[model samples]
Target: MDTASGLTYAVLGTGALGGYYGACLQKAGLEVHYLLRSDFDLVQRQGLVIESPDGDFALPQVNAYRRSPDMPRCDVVIVALKTTQNHLLPDLLPPVVKDDGVVLVLQNGLGVEAEAAAIAGPERVLGGLCFLCSNKVGPGRIRHLDYKKISMGEYSAAGEAVGITDRMRRIAADFERADIPIELAEDLVLARWKKLMWNIPFNGLSVVLNATTQDMMANPDARSLAEALMEEVMKGAAAQGRAIAPEFVQTMLDHTAKMKPYRTSMKIDYDEKRPLEVEAMYGNPLRAAQAVGARLPQIQTLYQQLRFLDAQNRGL
Candidate 1:
């Protein structure tokens, strides 16, 4: 909670999303500690390297810990791991979060807040959505394709629980000072759904077609399919009483066009034979549609096809 002296931050994943933000914070002169499995030695020896379209950076002083015993308590902890790794969090998070510390769930898709809260406690959980397009090109190296703003807010209904404490405000200020666009929102649910609306179509289609965002958008049939899926998602959102403007979907597609040649994390996972986040990004929304009695035939078809593709890609 000491804003003036800078806050202690623990980055849990140390992958593309986590590493980029952590490096930015370190550049801003904040104290940052990263928890890793075995790459601590590599990062320690060669430093954390971030390659962006703007340029590249190497943080030589990046601190890393291979185990909980080596991690110090921090004021804030960023959870940037894959949703499939949620089970590991109960054991991985406690050592880094002080009783009063905040743990920010920066993963993609919905339901992470509830899952993180169940483990870290609602009072200590915050939700964050990163807009950057990035990937872990290799151990100790992260490639940032797009540098979008970061949106954060309280995970609990109380609006200023463990996640959006005064300390988070200070951290956001520091991020802004470091030239990282950061926004604080009271209605994080809306923010989350807004991000989801973009992900369900783009993430799913990219993986299914084995293409980048631009590639998907370039094909007329693929672009139409994406638009159809987005319409279904919008209907589902409306049923939830969170109607998104039609223009919003257009804007998202436009944004992706500008971010051409970039691949989504789900696509990367599929290529690397890692477990895809299809459930969180695609399944959860379909469930919500059913819950709200919203019919989405097109999305249902796309989801089924994508699931099959995902299964084949993972040999599951």
Candidate 2:
């Protein structure tokens, strides 16, 4: 990895998460190649547009490719695609990752890093949980509503602490230089669960009621329900030997209370008639909890509802 000039990055998704992060890296003078499908022509012709609360910029000349074979193998391949598209990684990753490169899984939901690791190898895989509210509103255009911090972790099959590596620090420096705040997580499993504490409740309830975070928090019943669901996520994490402090739940609620009202990634995906990532986000968490005798009645109900709604949305 080139710390001075930043690693050559290939963004695999080119959607809200990918586009925002990649654009930030590009603007900071890093070499970024975006692997785009539907937005290829639009971005290749007009470049990518970012509308952020921090600031806004337009890239007039971006390296855009429609196929992996046409892309250069990069030092870091950021797989920011939705977990719903995990099925495509075995085919999409190899061409984008150099033999000595790293593959960063900047995605939501549980069990995502493992799936990415399968394609990029465990040692080569790193997991990133993006604490952001961003969405792609148009082809080549992304709307970054609020929050840009990311908790990044090393992927270890044993699910134990792997102290910060040179690679991890290098990537951290790269993000910090790009003005993006990052927390280096020594234990990836705990980090994933910490992220899920906020993810499971908000993402699920947002879709169930067709409401935003603020909307849910505004209604007393919905607010109570959201908090209850969050408790389940905490317990589920503990069941897997990842103990999250109960105080963090209040911290999460307070943080969200101050955040700008925004639609969750899952809600956005559902509204667009895309396949919802029910399995990774809900089903996997439920299974983990069940394995440890932790019952999540509220989450189980939400999971079933999302499954039904997701199947209908995807025409499954």
Instruction: Name the top TM-score candidate.
Output: 2
TM-scores of the candidates are 0.90, 0.95
Which lDDT values do the candidates have, in the order given? 0.80, 0.88
- Assess the local accuracy of residue 266 in candidate 2 as a C-alpha lDDT between 0 and 100: 86
- RMSD per prediction, one decimal? 2.9, 2.0
lDDT of 1 by residue, 31-108 (tens): 899987767889977879989876788897778888865799898888988888888888888788878788888988
Candidate 1 error regions (>4 Å): 1-5, 53-55, 157-168
TM-score for model 1? Answer: 0.90
Which pairs clash inside model 2? Answer: none
Error of 1 at 264 (Å): 2.1
